[model samples]
Target: MGLRKKVIWITGASSGIGEALAYEFNKKGAHLILSARRTGELERVKENCSNHEESVKILPLDLAEADQMEAKAVEALAMYGHVDMLINNGGVSQRSYAVDTEMSTVRKVMEVNFFGTVGLTKALLPEMIKQKSGHIVVISSVMGKFGTKFRSTYAASKHALHGYFDSLRQELYEHNVNVSLVCPGYVKTDVTINALTGSGEKFNKMGKGQKNAMPPEEFAKKLIPKLAAGKDEIYLGGAELMGVYLKRFVPGLFSKLLKRVRVT
Candidate 1:
């Protein structure tokens, strides 16, 4: 029941949290379908995993290309005959102010973070419903629960994910398909450096907060067990996590505090 032999498909598996999750899942004896836009990086991740030659398979995917996800989902299903879990982890972040950011940049963020993730889930949903077994895990963020400066579109995308998956969990309740949202705080990843800017360019510089964040490997180690236990939602890392609750319980104070925070 705890990931042994489970066919788990992970997107964004080329690096960071997704890469760490791949190793953790591999160690837990789960067969993995590793995916990302970079085939070479996926292969590198696969090689670093346990029993890669047999249990790991690389599936290069670009989440922004929403049109291709259906076919990719089919390919994923064919690999292991059935996917026990689908980890929707591919996404991009923003580091530009709302007014300065181009509409194209906003749409691009939505395409990769929200629409694309939902599109793939929709593609695989029927099969999961038919089989009446599967888990849809999303790597959302603490930003999903609250707004922040220079991340208007990024926060919007994650907020959309929360709404979509929350509804999906309710609808799929009888279908035996579990939906889990993982809201990680500040995890050590290339998120800030790869974040999109006003002109749709990468920020290319890491934030100081990110440098002090929890290690992706350590975060994955704590996360996988809770996920396997079927947790509906899990939060990890720093004091920013407190904002998730404060936003709910003390909106006024949370709003004031959010404005003063150095979110970058």
Candidate 2:
């Protein structure tokens, strides 16, 4: 169960939860492959790691580019010959109301959040199955569990991930390739500021709730232990996590609460 010397590839690793997880995993002696669209930022994260020279490698990638995933996966596996884990953490966020959002924006979000993640997973899956060991972890949002205002397509994309990954997990059970979904509530990150608006422009403003959400480092600290324990589904955040349960058990009440809660 220990991650020591394990080859772990993490996407969206330039900042936020991905970066934090990179540092934590590096601390645990894991060989890290840090990936993101920005090679410079990935280098920055690498330099900040405990043993960057020997333990960390940077791979630049854009999750929205589905066609490139297969090659990327091949390159990732080449980093340390075989990967023990792949964390599907790269994605974009939406801040537009459903009525005002453009179709292109919806497609863009889905490309990065849903199809892109799925493509990469499929590309690497056969290798994992052949190795008879691997972990696929996704950083899905709490939105995957329920819906609210201003996140129609974002919620839809995450919901789709749940359905697809759930089915994939069942199929991979016999193959011994573990699939886990990490549902995170609001966390202190640039997700909101970088969120696409109705016109497909960046929101560029920090959200009220996001400003006070759990720190990425703290979230990573709590998540790594659960992952090491081989948990299938892990939820991390503050009180916002309650919304998931509330939506599941008391649909009527959760619907009412959503009307009043400040999501953005």
* Residue 162 shift from truth in candidate 2, angstroms: 0.3
Q: Per-residue CA lDDT of candidate 2, range 1-264, in tens?
A: 788899999999999999999998998999999999999999999999987888999999999999999999999888899999999999999998899999999999999999999999999999999999999999999999998899999999999999999999999999999999999988999999999998899999998888988999999999998998888899998888998899889999989878987767
Once superposed on the true structure, which residue ranges of model 1 sit more than 4 Å away at CA? none
lDDT of 1: 0.93
Model 1: per-residue Cα lDDT over 172-228, one tens digit each: 999999999999999999999999998999999998779999999999999987887
Q: Single out the weakest 10-residue window by summed lDDT for candidate 1.
A: 255-264
How much RMSD separates candidate 2 from the native structure?
0.9
Model 1's TM-score against the true structure? 0.98
C-alpha root-mean-square deviation, candidate 1: 0.9
Separately for all candidates shown, the number of backbone clashes (residues 3 or more apart, or on different chains) is: 0, 0
The positional error of residue 235 in candidate 2, measured at the CA in angstroms, is: 0.8
